[model samples]
Target: MSEFFAHRRPGRPGLAVFVNAGDPPLALLPELVAMLDENEVDCLELAVPFPGSATDGPVVRASADRALATGVTPRAVLDTVASVRPGLRRLRIALLADWSHTVRGTAPGEFAAAARDAGCDGLLLHGVPPRLRTAHYEAVRRAGLPLVTTCYAVSGPDAVAEAVEHGSAYLYLVAHYGRSGTAAAWDRKRLGAVTATLRSAASAPVAVGFGVRTATDIEFLEGLGAEAAVVGSAGVARMEQARAAGRDPVGELQSFVRELRTPQPSHTPADGRKRGIHP
Candidate 1:
C-alpha cells in the first residue's frame, strides 16, 4: 500500500484533489500544493502534460495546454514534485498516466519509477486494461506505490462491486459518464446505491469526481458514504476569477479551499462505516 493510504485504512472515503502540474506556471506549483494541503486535501493527483487528453473536458484540457505550452516535460514535472514534496508529508501525490505508449522505449515501469522517485504516493494509471497484467501492477508495487483506477462512464452496481473485489487501492467514481464540469444537482439516490455496491465489493475507499463543484455536492457525497469529492472546474474558475480581479490566484485558492472544507455531521457509508470530516 502507498504510505498515504496505509496511514488511513480502507474505511471511509478520502478526498483526493487533481491538479495540473505547471498549470499556472512551474514556479507557482509549490505554493499551490501547500495551499491544498492547508485546506485539507488528503491526496493530490498531478496530471502530467500530454498532447491529447480525450477524456478531459475544457477545464482540465486547458490546464493541460498551459502546462505543455510552458514546456512541462516528464522530467520537469518530476523535478517540481521533488522540490515541493519534502514539506508536504500530509499530501500524497498520484501521477496521471497518459499517452505512455507513444514514448519511445519507455515502459510503464519507467513511469511508475519516475513518479515514486518524485515522492508520489500512488499511480493513477488511465487507459490500461481493466484486468491489468501482473507484471504491470508489480512494476508499480515495486516502487511502493498503489494503483488507483477510475470507473469512468460505468454505472452498474455489479460492475462496481467487481471493481472493488480487484484490490483497487482506491476507486475513482466518475460523477458523470461524460466530460468534467461544474455540476449542480446530482442523482444522489443512484449515486448512493453505487456507493453502497462499491463498499460491499472493495476494501479500498471510493471517491467521486469529474463534476463536483459546490459544498452541497460534497455534502451529498458524504451522505452516500463517499470518501471524497473532487472539484476541478470550480478550482479553475476560482483561478480565472482571481486573475480577472488582479488578486493572487494562490491567495484566492486559500479562501476557496476554506469554503470547501467546512464540516458537517456524520453520514453512513454502504459498508456502515461512519463518515467524519476528518480532513
Candidate 2:
C-alpha cells in the first residue's frame, strides 16, 4: 500500500471525492485541493475530462463537458495536480484517465511514469479493455505507481479476482451496474456479502461508490465492512452549484466534505439549510 492508505487508521470511514480537472478551472484547482486537504478528505480522484463515459451520469457528464470545453488535456491535468501535491498535508490524488480518449496514443509505461512524476499517488485507468489489461498492469508495475483497480459489485468472479489481485492502493467496488450514482436505493443484503468478499480478498482498502451521497450512506458502508465510501456525482454537483450561484466553489465543496465527515444524522451547516447529496 502507498503511504496514502497506509496511514489511514480504522476510524472515520475514508471519504474520497471526485472532480474534473478543469471544471473549476485549472487556475483555481489548487485552491480547491487545498480546501479538500484542510477539510480532511482522504483522497481526490482527479479525472481528465472525456465525452460519453459509460459509467457517468448527467451531473458528472456535465462536469466533464465543462472541463473539456475549457480545453483541459491529460498532461495539463497532471501539471495541475503536481502544483497542488506539495501543499497537501493529507489528501492523496489518484489520476483518473479514460483509456481510449486520454491514453490511447501514449505508451502505457510512459503515461504511468508521467503520473508518478507529477506526484500522483495512484493511477486509475478507466474504460480499459480486458484484452489490454496485462499491458496496463505491467506499465504501472514498471513505473512503481500504486494501482486503483475497480469492479462492479455484481461482477463475476473473474472481474473480482482481477481487481483484488492487482489492486494495491485501493479497490473501487462500484455499487451497481448502471451509470455512476444513478441507483435509487442500496440493497443492503446483497451488498453486505459483496463487501465481505472484497474485504476478505483485497489487501488494499475497499471503497464503495455509486449512489453514495450522505454521511449516513458512508456510515452504512463502514458498517458493511468497507474501508471507505466514495462520493463522486454529489461532490461535483456541489461545485457546479456553487459556481452557478456565484459562491466560492472551494468553500462550498469544503462544506460538503465537512458534512460527510461529520457523524450526525441530520447535517446542518451554519445557514441551517437541509442539503440533499443525491446523485
Candidate 3:
C-alpha cells in the first residue's frame, strides 16, 4: 500500500491540507511544512502552479499568480520539497500538478523520476481522466512512484471502477461537480450515493475533496465512508487573510487545521441511539 493510504484510520477520516508552492516565497516552505507536521496534518499536498489550470478557483488562482510572479518553476518546487523532506517525518507528501507541469519539455518517465527523487511519496495529476492515463501510469510506474487519480460523481460507476483500477495510491472523489472553491452547499444525499458507489468499487482508500471546508464537513465525510478529507482553497484563503492583516500566516493555518481536526458533538437519530461524529 502507498504511504498516503496506509496512514488512514478505519473510522476517523484523515486530514489533508493543500498549499501552493512558493505562494508568497519558497524560503518559507520548510517552516510551513514543519508546522503542519507538528500539528498532525496527515498529508501535505504541494500544488505546482501552471499558467492554465482548469481546476483552480479564484483563491487558488490568486495564489498561483503570486507564485508565478516570483518565478516559481516546477524545478524550484521539487527542490523545495527535497530540502524540506527530512523535517516532515510523520507527514505524507504528494505533488499536485497538471500533465503540462509534470512533463515540461522532457519525457514523462524523466519527470516522474525527478519528482520521486525530490521526496514526494505520490503524484496527483489534475484534469486527466482515468481512460486517458495509461501512458502517465506507465511512466510513474517505471519511476517507482504511486499515481493518484480523481473520480467524479457524474462519471458514474464504470468510470469510478476504471479510476480505481488505474490509481495506485488512492482515488480523489470530487464532492461536487465544479471548480476548487465554490460557496455552493453540499448535497448530502448525492454525496452519500456517490461515496457508496466509490467505496464499492475502490480497492484503496477513497478521499473526498473540492468542496470541503470545515470540521463538520470532515465529520460528514467520515459518515459517508470516506477515508480522508482534503481542504484546499479554504486553507489558502486563511493564509491570505492572515497575510493581509499583518498576522503570521503559519500561525493562522495551524489554528485552522487544529479546529478542523477537532471533533464535534454527535446528534441522536430517530432510532434513539447516539452515535459519535465519526463512524
Candidate 4:
C-alpha cells in the first residue's frame, strides 16, 4: 500500500488538493510541496498540462492553459516530482495525467513505468479509452504502482466494480457527471449511498471529488463514509487569485488547508476567509 494510505485511522476525511503542475510555476513547486508536507496534508494530486479537457471547469481549464503557456510538459512534471521526492516526509504525490493529451504516444505499460521511475506514489490517468482500460490496469499492476481508479457517483455496477478492483490506492468517487466545479448543489442522498456502497466493496479507502469546495463539504462527506475529499477547482481558484494579487499561492493554500481542519460556525463561508465590515 502507498504510505499515504497505509496508516489509515477512522476520523474526519483527509484533504487532497489538485493543481496544475506549472500554474504556480514548476520552479516553486518543490517549495509548495515541502510546505504541504510540513503541514501534513495527505496528497498532492499534480496534473500535467493538457488542453481541451471535457471534464474540467473554467477554473481548472484556465489553470491548464496557464501551465501549458509556460511550456509545462509531462517530462517536466515528472522531473519535478523526482526532485522533490527526497525532501518529502509525509505528503505523497499522485501524478494525474490525461491519456489523450499526455500519454498518447507512449504505451500504457511504458507510461506506468515512467511514473514509477519518477517517484510518483500513485497515479490517476484521465481520458482513458475503454479498449485500453485492461492495458492500463495491467501496466499499473506490473509496475507495482498504486492506482487511483475513478467512477461517477451514479456509475453502474460494472464501472464501480472496475474502480474498486484496480484501485489499490483509493477510488475517486466523482460527486456528479457534469463539468468539474459546476455543480450548484451536492447530491447528499445519492453520494451517501454510493460512498457507503464503494466503502463496503473496496479494501482501500474511497475518496469523494467534484464540487467539493468548502470545509463543510468535507465534513459532510466524512459523515457519508468518504475517506478523503479531493479539493480541486476551489484550490486552483484560490491559487490563481493569490498569484494574480502578488500573494504567495502556497501560503494561500496553507491557509486553506488550515481552514479545513479548523472549527467553524453553523454556516462557514465557502472561501473560509474572515471578512471585516470595516474593510
- Which sections of candidate 2 miss by over 4 Å? 265-279
Off by over 4 Å in 4: 7-10, 265-279
lDDT of each: 0.69, 0.84, 0.80, 0.83
Question: What ranges in model 3 sit over 4 Å off?
Answer: 8-10, 102-104, 129-132, 267-279
Q: lDDT tens digits, residues 47-148, model 4?
A: 988998999999999999999999987888889898889888778888899988888788657887888899998889898899988888888889888999
Cα deviation in Å at residue 62, candidate 3? 0.6
Q: What is the TM-score of each predicted model, taking all chains together?
A: 0.82, 0.92, 0.90, 0.92
Off by over 4 Å in 1: 1-13, 101-105, 129-135, 156-162, 165-168, 182-185, 263-279
Give the alpha carbon lDDT tens digit for every residue of 71-105 in model 2: 98888888888887888888989889888997888
lDDT-sorted candidate list, best first: 2, 4, 3, 1
In model 1, the Cα lDDT at residue 95 comes to 77
lDDT per residue for candidate 1 within 1-279, as digits (tens), equals: 354434433443356667777777778989989987766577877877775666777778887787788988878888988999889757778777673432335675777777778887777765565455455667667766777766743466555654565435577888666667634335555667777777676777777887666565576677688877666777876876787798888887778767776665555667643322122
Model 4 TM-score? 0.92
How many clashes show up per model? 2, 0, 0, 0
